[model samples]
Target: MTRSVYVTGIGRGDGRQVIELGVMELLTRHVDRVGVFRPLVHDDGPDRLFDLLRSRYRLTQPADSVYGMGYEAAGTLQAERGTDELVSHLVDRFHAVAREYDYVLVLGTDYADTNLPDELSLNARLANEFGASVLPVVAGRDQESESVRAEARNAYRAFDSMGCDVVAMVVNRVAPADREAVVERLAAHLPVPCYALPEDSSLSAPTVSQIVHTLGGEVLLGDDSGLARDARDFVFGGAMLPTFLKALTDGCLVVAPGDRADLIIGALAAHSAGAPPIAGVLLTLGERPGPDIMALAARLAPGTPVISVPGGSFPTAGELFAIEGKMSAASPRKAETALGLFERHVDTVELTKRISVLKSDRVTPMMFEHELIERSRSGRRRVVLPEGSEERVLRAADVLLRRDVCDLTLLGEEEAIRKRASDLSIDLGDAQIIDPQTAPVRERFAERYAELRAHKGVTQELAYDVVADVSYFGTLMVQEGLADGMVSGAVHSTAATIRPAFEVIKTKPDAQIVSSVFFMCLADRVLVYGDCAVNPDPNAEQLADIAIQSAATAAQFGVEPRIAMLSYSTGTSGSGADVDKVRKATELVRERRPDLLVEGPIQYDAAVDASVARTKLPESEVAGRATVLVFPDLNTGNNTYKAVQRSAGAVAVGPVLQGLRKPVNDLSRGALVQDIVNTVAITAIQAQGGTAQDAPSGR
Candidate 1:
């Protein structure tokens, strides 16, 4: 039978979606197939929670299957057929979905616009009838600590008194300072697990995209990515440009008359130079700057959003202030922050045990993504992005800071980076920004570089010039115990990005060469594809070393290594130099690490496809279930990964460089914001001893 969890709240403003999304994350982590059902929803618009859950988890269940009745229909059914019949009909619809999935997440109704009486009792009765464990959430925002504690206990009692299976209690949006006392008080009194989540403004802050959508504004310049930037505060720009620029805050939305061209250009210029990333420029009073001025603003901050609203500044400000940010599919960064916050505060082990759901063997993409963030945050590490001025890198840095995933240092002109960040309205917080051209360590680093390259006849002058490059400077930072790791190549070539590391950081003692792997996140599992981004053609020895290194990388990220040495032929069925090289590599891996489960001279199909494995090499352990696939050469590996990525629509998360003394990875020139974030997280984990050698401390 499928286990069911009904996440409900006593009233409105409880922020219960956090609990719902958090529970969905936990369920997907343990089981492959999880379904969501909302007993009733508003017909005025799309269901935000359901949309987010479906899109984020890639749920295959049809939209119509997710809801039993809309609010209007449910009210009519209650008036005509009575409450019992209304619930009974909804119960049938819920069961239809429940029977088809291993676990069903039932979202309870929001108390908004529900004219029905005794809603709390109704939800409890419905949960009992559905035979689902109840998880009650209480809104603790703007409440005293004692009141928050009482409300939490009262919520639990309301569900328990109705004889509903109350599994846990969550008090959300409590003041950060009061969360500990609230959790302690609730846990002391409640029979079940109690979790208290502190108030996180990021979850509630409207993004520039959300503001634009809400206000029906026209996008004058910024692209969709910049539009998605979070607007943490709305600053009115009614003063002169100097005063206005001074008032600018991180992630703030600038509200001024469209005629204020000076303010507009100044804001965009400040953002371009990385003052603080503004959310966007909201022009008011039904007016707009002339094309000439608009052109200058666009040039100042290329893709930063410039929006025009017809309303006056005051009315627009009122509308924005009243607008409540929602959990939507469009704002995935907020969803991630919510998940991280929930995971940090809630005891999933206790909640899962209470729910008693069986674990599934498969790991979903959502699970893998969540696991990456969770692992990276366990022991935070410092990571430097050399191409800090790149749009994708700046956006990713915003996400990394908001999630508290790592300590970051952006290697660039501090003033320019801050201006860009301000224009984007992204708050870098304590993330250090350095100018490689003027850093105090430059001369010292140049001298050190000269000493290290003395055998190659490198002079101090040449070393000084090379150290001026951001990549070389960042690598020196790592070498000199300044940063933990580095992730570059958002705009730089791979050779340009990694050459500094190759010269200074170099490979570990145990590693014969440096290689790379892509964590191919498929629908039902995460597979490791190696040498896809590095090493052109490997002989047997280098191929074997790549296999070993790839296996270690797989294990570090929690994938058990079942190495498959890929070849055009399967198990000596064909003879050629390529197949022979793979055969030799397999033998060398066995000789080096006999305990590793390995199968070699295997065709691509046999390595991953069960039916093909049975037809080709049935008895081999690594034939069908290989988690790590080491290709014979880069030509085949790179092409195969790209093909699978494009055709199969998988998220390939690396070219994660392995065997470096310190964790330094490269990004694709076309990398998106999320790709940069993932690569940085990987780099941080690598720095945290996710690899063989522990990252040297103080670096």
Candidate 2:
């Protein structure tokens, strides 16, 4: 049977979409296939909530399968044919979606300008008829704590009294100051779990693209990517250019008459110089700059959007106030913010317990990627990027900041980094920017480096020289507790990045040698390939340590560890130095960690193919289900990782340096923006003691 959850609200302005998105996120995390159904939508033009859920979660269900009836049609049917006919129609439509998916996320009615009577009771009836549990979200904005608590309890009772199973109550848009009191009061009154979500302006703020669409403005400048940037506030440009620039705020949309070339050029110039990135230039009165000015403005802020609106500034301001932000496919940052807020406040354990959502058996690639980011945000750790001036690293920083995933410090020349960010239209947003040569802690880092390398005969002057390098400086920041971890090598070699950690940060007490792994995210699952980027050739003992470290890394990232020590032969069918090395390593791993499931001298086919494993090593516990693949040499590991990455279209997320005292990871010099983001997330998770965590015991 398909499980269903109906996220409904009592009145408008309840921000129930956040609850819907949150519930969908929870559902996706629990089950592999989840569908969405909105009982009644207001219009045919694309349901905002459904579009967002579909795009964000990669849902396969068609949009037509989601909606039961249009609002006007539903009202007419209820008035003409009575409520029973309307309810029956909706239930049938709901069942159509329910049968196809493992779980159906039923979005209840928004108590907007509907003609229906007793909106709350109607929602309850629909949820009950659909055999769905109710999760009510009450709008607590501007309400007192007592009132918020009262409304929550009343809503719960309303559904419970109707024989509907009320799974949970969410108090959305509660004032930040009143969250504690409201939650506490509700805890003493409500029969179910209550999650209080405080107001977050970022999630509710309109983006540059939304403003342009709402006003029917023409894009005179900027690319689609830059237009997706959020417009958090509106800055009216009425004064002189100098005065107007001072009124600027981060993510503010500049509203000014288009004829004012001074303001337009100045705003673009300020954005390019990285004072604060304006969301976009909203030119009013349908006035536009000359061709020469537009050309110059485009050059000034290459991708900064410049929009021309028909109305004057005053009417535009009114429209802006009336415009509300919705979580759509374009505005994904707000989605991340909403998910973060929901994850932080909700007791998902309790909510899932009531809903009976099952954990997925197969870990999809998307799920693996999502888990990396979710776990990184669960316990955010500070990670420093030494290649701050590198465009890819800066772009990744922009993504990390937008997601609120981790605290980041970018190490380099501040001016150069800012200029590069401006050129790329990237927003660093309070991410610490440090110049290794001139940082206040330079001398302290130098002294520490000198002491650590004293046996290597390093002097203070020499230490200062080494500390001037950004990679070493970043590693020192991690060592001195300035940052939790460091991710570099976007521009430098891997050796240049990790050599500093080897010299200063060093290895853990228990680690015999340093190794690295690439999280090979294939079509269906994530596998760990060890010593792929480090340790050219490891002896038996080092290979064993690598296996242990790789298994721990796999477990920490939520993949259950099943070790398969790879060789050219399966189960001693052949013997050589390489096979013998892997065989000894497998025995060592079993002896050292008796609880670990390990198989030795396994060929690639038997290690991953079930039928081949049955013919070759069916009795082995780790064969055909191994999550961690340990290689005896870097030559094989690196070649295999690259081959899989290129030919199979796999996402290789690492070269995650393991066994470091503190987390210091290296990135590919040709790394994409997303690759940097993933590596940074891995480093942050590592800094949070992710490696020490044990995965769930069973699949």
Candidate 3:
């Protein structure tokens, strides 16, 4: 039976990281269930705190971070001084997630001053609410006895009143020489377990298999510690997605990037509804796991291992990733990261066995489990395809509004809108439609008729009539503050779509120009090619800016920026106006931003071909490989990029509108529904605000 065990702590110092790390450490040892509780999350958002914990413990559930999480109001709320309410609320959240798991670790706040009375109340309350035991690890200058003993006594005295016997106070930060004395004193005086735990800043990762296999170890406690289970000469191997998923489908341990834990968590959560413990977790970051996560892991397996990496998650994620990724439904990364992940973590037999299980599942379920999890958790994406008829615009209006992509105001009559949608077998149940004749912007335009309109718009009635079309009304909506942005090029020319944005939205105060970027994804990476859709032929200054900005974007997306300014020749092999332009642009870029690594006047082969690059420009910053490619002209860039898009069978995800105050975009006249959906998601992500980091870099 799973019981919610909320772990509470009174700290040796700022118990935030230590308390969290300790709870996470304990979470790995439990076989039942667990949850995390904090009196207050300091000044941080409760959701953010939970997110950090979730990231650490490999939590991938679909609910918001706050769901199954308890929170206390900011301290200014008076009455119980907030801490009291926070404690009460945290207890509730603990019990909630606890209902699903076996234990919950409740950590106390780092109370400044000697607020022993309030701190005492909080711990006692935890025990009363969740029947939790207090684990007060007293930390000091050096887990010394004399310096920390007095505080330990006070902490113990506080817990003593609540029917707690001698309290356990583990001395923290002790000098090596003092370790023996500290533990001896605490054990002698304390009524309970007073074992001293040293600062384990870099403890080695121990596997269950290792525990089962070790020959000369003393079994201190627990089932595996009993020296009963047989050890294995197990080896992990393979780097196939199908095979990886098979190991993950049931209960097998896997390691992956801390960032991608959600991928693992989501899959395990879904599978656990039917199957056994899917696996343990190896998070490749120094992130601390959350209580909710401890609970989730316990639900799936007897216990899941949660370990943080030494260097960092980004570099260490290869341990188990490649093998498990093969089993994931979407297979987000190319096989390189996966294979590297698997080869580095476990050995051959384990890999082969995992693959066999995955292949067998393929025949049994005929479905990829990873994909189902991703689909269920993926937020719905929406876009405005205000075409077909006035009714079509109306039908798509509400979806646009609710998605918050842009507030849509359609141009049509209510009755006629319904009639047209009915005729076309469309649905318009959720649109905010207004007759263009009655549109406020159109009316204002009409009132200023003669002065702004052509000879065709002489009278007020004529002005109102001319401005009343759906296109005219949509344009008006953009002009007003009614929409964040708009995208309507389908059934219209690029001119029609762009003309409105330029006229209404206009450019930013200092934006001298606006350009476009095209993304090309090959087998291993996605390359960003720029200035293909905008600026027919840019001057050297503008070209330099594009190069600098594109490089910045590359850096943002985990790609090291190596910019290549491409021309037909390598260096001075050709002499022409175009070559001169490319040379000048490259020179200006280096001169303006000397720190930026840049190279140019290189042939495409020199820029992209490693061998050719070695021969022509071995010392160049970009040399053989560049993340951002700057072409000399639109003709070459536009045609080459389109050819790559078509022939490579690669996803060309953009002309993703760049340099926007807000992410207003334009849709291609002919785009599929998937295209529309992806664009909308990208736009929404942009609206959330992005730094250069969101840019797509080489995988």
Top candidate by lDDT: 1
Q: Please report the TM-score between candidate 1 and the true structure.
A: 0.90
Q: What is model 3's C-alpha RMSD?
A: 24.5
2 versus 3: better lDDT goes to: 2
**If scored against the real structure, what TM-score would every candidate get?**
0.90, 0.91, 0.42
* Tens-digit lDDT track of model 2 for 116-229: 999889999999998898898999989999989888888888889989899889999999999999999998988778999999887787877888889999999988767877
* Ranking of candidates on lDDT, top first: 1, 2, 3
* Cα deviation of 181, candidate 3, in Å: 51
Q: Assess each prediction's global lDDT (C-alpha) against the native.
A: 0.87, 0.86, 0.49
Measured on C-alpha atoms, candidate 1 has an lDDT of: 0.87
Candidate 1: worst 10 consecutive residues by lDDT?
A: 690-699
Local accuracy of candidate 1 as per-residue lDDT tens digits, 74-167: 8888999899999899889989998899999999989999887788988898898889999999999999999998888888877888999998
Q: Give candidate 1 misplaced runs (Cα > 4 Å).
A: 208-231, 234-320, 349-352, 609-619, 690-699
After superposition, which runs of candidate 3 have C-alpha atoms over 4 Å from their true positions?
1-437, 444-472, 548-561, 591-596, 692-696
Angstrom error of the Cα, residue 695, model 2: value is 4.4
lDDT of 2: 0.86
Candidate 2 lDDT at 360 equals 70
